[model samples]
Target: MASLKGLGYSGGMDIAQLKAFPLFAELPDAALSHIARGATPLAFPRGALICRKGEFIQGFYCVLEGVVKLAFLSPEGHEKIVDLVHGGSSFGEALMFLDRPCPLYAQALTRCQLIHVRKEAILPALDRYSSLARQMLAGLSRRLHQLVLDLESYCMQPAAQRIIGYLLREAETHEGQTREVTFPVSKALIASRLNVTPETLSRTLSCLSEQGLLKVEGKRILIHDVERLRDLGPR
Candidate 1:
């Protein structure tokens, strides 16, 4: 278990950092400053539980650094990773408005710095900034689409194809024939996210390696044939 640090409503919250998020990018300086005033900075070390299933929602959380795993526990006590929220991303925006308990757990995959934007602050900001509301809706819609894709993959696609699709999507930011991807969280967590057992994930990677598609070294994966891997991905 990792120790937690709470910086309660830091008065020096950065307006520029808030601007970097698409949700607040278009807001005027005054609006951004208003949000900054109510934002609380929280630090969680690796393995810290940020939020738990059924916990009352406090506010929206924006990841400033490191990664957080959004997950839920299975009936058999297994932790199933639903999504990995990385730096520059925000979570719980929709829930903040709904006034309900969180449906999933959020845990720090590594040491993390996060901003908790209080619902009180956000509600008034929304009323003042129409663009912010649109961006929030757009963000929620995108999240829904991703969930639908995940459901489709789980129902209709093979495990190997799902893995290939994940790798290809990760490589999209880079331009090259070969790319290296370091799993931000443990391979087991990724396996859970992809709805596969750890052993199954290993076997699939081994199969891909034997086919000269990619090479795996622990958490680091090196794609040797990007085109072939892409071809194997979901259509």
Candidate 2:
């Protein structure tokens, strides 16, 4: 809800919990301190835009808390959800690395805290810290893998399979079989991520529910059969 200066994160979030992030986990104490010196923390309430399309992105950002929705807007005023980024996940790297403006808008889906390191500051830190370099490389590799998967989904998968696959992947990666993984965002936003119309998504979910594959109770989704859902992946 407040800006970085308002949150009192004049230094980076250099805590043990930060180590849980594979990207920042291996840095030496000195490097971590250097990073901490320049980093700042900010908070956003749900539905607030952290960054917008065509804005000049200055650095890399990691979620210290809550979830963010990365999305794109069409010239005709259509919103397409691209990714749901949660805590420990990072974004804005593409713009930072390429020295270009942001291509998508990042909005907070829940009240959130975030830490950021400017590109200028990080370059010197990375030069002195091989571990940091390795971490960056690992992050890039992971991002590439995700991109490949997304491209595959867009190019080859049918809408039914894509929607089901999205839910199953979210369940595995983010939900982990909790009583019911809260559907963190609206179905319309989710339909955009899966490249389907909201009506189509509703119909697909109804079909799945009718078949005993899943139960949609308001915003919560109970996955009755994860493997059956997984099998919805592309052939």
Candidate 3:
């Protein structure tokens, strides 16, 4: 269960906070202010269940700080990480249009703040602002494209390829052949995200360590060979 009494920013979102997100950035001040009036500012502690399957989402949520993951949980306790929403991004846009129960559970991976924009607030905005509608549709299209790519990875890629690809995504900066990637959440969550078991994840990391590819240090991994890792990704 999630507690609504999150620390700080208990009131409705201000127009500035609304504009901070690209989805609403192009909207006029008056439109944004109107939408902000209905928006709810919320915070959640790490490990809190933000929303669950079968819940009727009145609107989408935008991450203002920290990370939230959309996932599926089986009755037998198995878990699959569908996507991770970081700061400055929004989720559940499709839900508003679908008019159906949410299919996945959402949980906070870290202490996070979000703006829950009601469907009522956005529908009128979308009707009035073509830019806002386009942005929202673009966001949804990107998510769908990524989902297709994920399906391809899950179906066609080998386990090592998938793991290496996962590690390489966070390799935004590197010194020579070395780069560092930090796990923002637990290894269990990571394994689920990669569609692998904890034992498999451990074994793969150890193998890479033995091969002088990377060094694992509790939540951080130093990649010693970026090119080699990339070569292994999706190949």
Candidate 4:
């Protein structure tokens, strides 16, 4: 598939594209224009390392297309995915604002196009536009809340419960008695994200299948009954 920048973001991302992001959505055109001018547009192939841990982030970035994962890597090469950031989402804002080294590294899961908006440009804009500061705070708050929830789930939930909870969360849009959940990345990558071994994930899926709760076909799972699956775990 063709990448996003290849579709229309040629040369560099324009103010209109910058304005489409939630952080910039409320800013005036002039402020958006300034920020866009300073932002760097870049593309990456799958498996590209966008940034490394311990490196200082000079700016925040937003993915225009494709998927990326922010993860921590061990010296022995094991990985733990902290977040699966998809198109239209942003990262690095808090790290940049805090002037600290990144705790996690970002890598592309597919061909990706992103814009890096510099602190130099954003600081002035934030000073000029009070709403921008509020939006930044709101975004960071959401991330922190999610992290807390994740910690709770990791500490309290069992492996099957975590995997089932993930399915229900992903199947939120599907209506009626039946629902479907699709894995955005490979099951191995997902296993890492959920803090489970691939073998355990396969075993759990088989267990669920044997119970007639769902049918797994490749990366897509057809949920037989949403309520049954939901009732299997937490209330």
TM-score of each: 0.65, 0.62, 0.66, 0.63
Task: Give the top-scoring candidate (lDDT).
Answer: 3
Candidate 3: where is the Cα deviation over 4 Å? 1-8, 157-235
Model 1 clashing residue pairs (backbone): none
User: How would you encode candidate 1's per-residue C-alpha lDDT over 179-231 as one tens digit per residue?
Assistant: 88878899999999999888888987887787677899989899998866664
Tens digit of per-residue lDDT, candidate 3, span 1-235: 5534455474556788888899988888999889987788888899888887889889999999999999997678867688999999999999999899999989999999989889999999899999999999899999998787556444533776778878887776444344888898999999999999888889888877866778999999988987656644664
* Positional deviation of residue 107's Cα in model 2 after best superposition, in angstroms: 0.5
- lDDT by residue (tens digit), candidate 4, 90-153: 9998876688999998888999888878889888988889788988889889889878755643
Give the whole-model CA lDDT for all candidates, comma-separated: 0.82, 0.74, 0.84, 0.80
Please list the Cα RMSD from the true structure of every candidate, rounded to 1 decimal place: 10.9, 10.8, 10.7, 11.3
Steric clashes per prediction: 0, 2, 0, 0
Question: How would you order the candidates by lDDT, starting with the best?
Answer: 3, 1, 4, 2
The weakest ten consecutive residues by lDDT in model 2 span: 1-10
Ranking by TM-score: 3, 1, 4, 2
| Predicted model with the maximum TM-score | 3
Clashing residue pairs for model 4 = none
